[model samples]
Target: MPRFTDAFRVAEESGQTMAEYGVVLALVTLAVLAALTMLGANVSSALTGVANLLP
Candidate 1:
């Protein structure tokens, strides 16, 4: 029936959309992790400097 075919099509499209969202989320997570790793040492030093100035 037409309704059955439509339901299948919708499910397939939904799956594709979910896959795309998952890929984007993975890429964004990787980017954030890379940024933190690259900045970790500088951020630590900056915090230490501020702490030293306080006490």
Candidate 2:
């Protein structure tokens, strides 16, 4: 009855929240990976330059 519907609603809300969190986490992970991929070569080259200069 009323109590059962309330319990169900709470569960549905919690599940929705979990889905939102998962989507956000996935987006953040993608952004970070893309940034690293784009910058990886540049960073490596810079480090090599620094190393060459040190010696």
Clashing pairs in 2: none
lDDT of 2 by residue, 1-55 (tens): 4676666555447878899999999999999999999999999999999999995
Candidate 2 lDDT trough over 10 residues, lowest sum: 3-12
Pull out the clashing pairs in model 1. none
Superposed model 1: Cα runs more than 4 Å off: 1-11
Question: On a 0 to 100 scale, what is the lDDT of residue 15 in model 2?
Answer: 77
In angstroms, give how far residue 36 of model 1 lies from its true place.
1.1
lDDT (0 to 1) per candidate: 0.90, 0.89
lDDT of 2 at 44: 97
Stretches of candidate 2 above 4 Å error? 1-11, 51-55
